[model samples]
Target: MTGEDILYPPRASAFSWRIFKTGEIHTVSVGRRKFSADFQLVFRLIKGLIFLTFISILVTMIALPHMTIQDIVVCILAFMPTGWGMLQIAQALKPLVRRAGFWGSVKTLARGYEIVMGLLLFTPVAFLAWFPFVSEFQTRMLFNQAFSRGLQISRILGGQRKGRSSRNKE
Candidate 1:
């Protein structure tokens, strides 16, 4: 192992979807008959698809709105990402609730809530919540620029820079 690698091990996975999916198996046995079902796989697949849909809607809301699309489309797509994010957050909290028990789970979820709130407050996504439609070309362009800059600022404030050790003690 390299010096850096020794100094910095990968962060413990806070939450894992794979564990939710294919982590547990359910079976029933009655009088020498066994019935088994793989529910995790299905659940995981749905979550993954929801994640994908969220991403696509985010991109569409940010990009496609400028390409002469209808205002309704932009407004509808804008909310999808937030809804999907909430779903994933709920999913993430399940393991915490199970492993940490009630109070610990609440603490963990509160931390996650803070992170999400910070993201929403710092980005143009916050404005979209109130006024989602792009009414004018100039307004759309202005928002496009705002979103780009807001994203950059958000990264600087909350995101880890690339190629650096994630284990850096803050």
Candidate 2:
């Protein structure tokens, strides 16, 4: 391999849908580079905490009789991405199940359970996304990393332009 290749490895790329400000959804390429183990752990921990928080809020909204329609709608919008993310974790773990030993067999059963749960979780969201705005919002939430990366690139380019402008004025 060349020195440049060794120094700067190629980033992983995946295709995902992105929602534009004008309410158009389009499939776009996104980076999927590996994160540090520590970062992964912390990110998973934070995600779990956020999921729990949303679940609690949802339960409260259901249990209270004084909930407004707006509150219900807001809760649903917030909860979809949280639930989708958790199900995604379950889907990710399915392939890791082993089936050779007793524990492996147990894990296989657990994997089956996870698959069932993932289907259950996905069904409602799949239906909900049939609506245009809901689908746009869901896509925006799920592919947020792509949007953030775009913003970062813009900021860097903007800074470079400003630097050139200042140098030209000097």
Candidate 3:
């Protein structure tokens, strides 16, 4: 046993095991010690739910002839903040993506493409000042860690709009 291992012993908790079983905890091996990363588990779960919601909406729009172009436009506009939020989340998780290998790289590129398309589709809404606020709120509710990381990225990127702040700002 190494001195480092003795100083920082690993404890296998029931909660960690449960999360592991759900496939959210990824075990990363460094030397002989294995570590489970539970950091982005909540964020992944929330993203999965949001993706399913988007898919369902797309199916509904395709199946219903009654859904007009205006309705589609409105939906796109409404989801702009969400797209932006996802972008921020993606940025925050870039390090993890690098470690995730080829498929992760492909997914990141796909997400970038989708964000660009959405911005083009709703160019006017993309300039709105309220998007950051909404995105922050969504991030806070879903994953606090991502929220903080996103804020740091936003600060570094600059160009944030000044307006009425959300209640959750600290």
lDDT values, one for every candidate: 0.46, 0.49, 0.50
Candidate 2: stretches off by over 4 Å: 1-101, 138-160, 168-170
lDDT of 1 by residue, 1-170 (tens): 87644543332111222122112111111111222254656555655665676567546644643323454354435434543564466567777645643433334444655786688677765565466463464476767876766657666656555425566643
Error of 3 at 4 (Å): 61
The CA-based lDDT of model 3 is what? Answer: 0.50
Can you write out model 2's per-residue Cα lDDT over 66-96, one digit (the tens) per residue? 4466645654455445445544564566555
TM-score for each predicted model, relative to the true structure: 0.23, 0.26, 0.27
Once superposed on the true structure, which residue ranges of model 3 sit more than 4 Å away at CA?
Answer: 1-60, 102-170
Better of 1 and 2 by lDDT: 2
Q: Alpha carbon lDDT of residue 33, candidate 3?
A: 28
Where does model 1 exceed 4 Å of error? 1-38, 67-111, 115-170
lDDT of 3 by residue, 44-132 (tens): 55557656755675566445534456655655555555545554676778777567643343354456558778887788655653678
> For model 2, what is the error of residue 44's alpha carbon versus the real structure, in angstroms, after optimal superposition?
41
In model 1, what are the clashing residue pairs, if there are any? none
Cα lDDT for residue 79, candidate 3: 50
The deviation in Å at residue 120 for candidate 1 is 11
lDDT of 1: 0.46
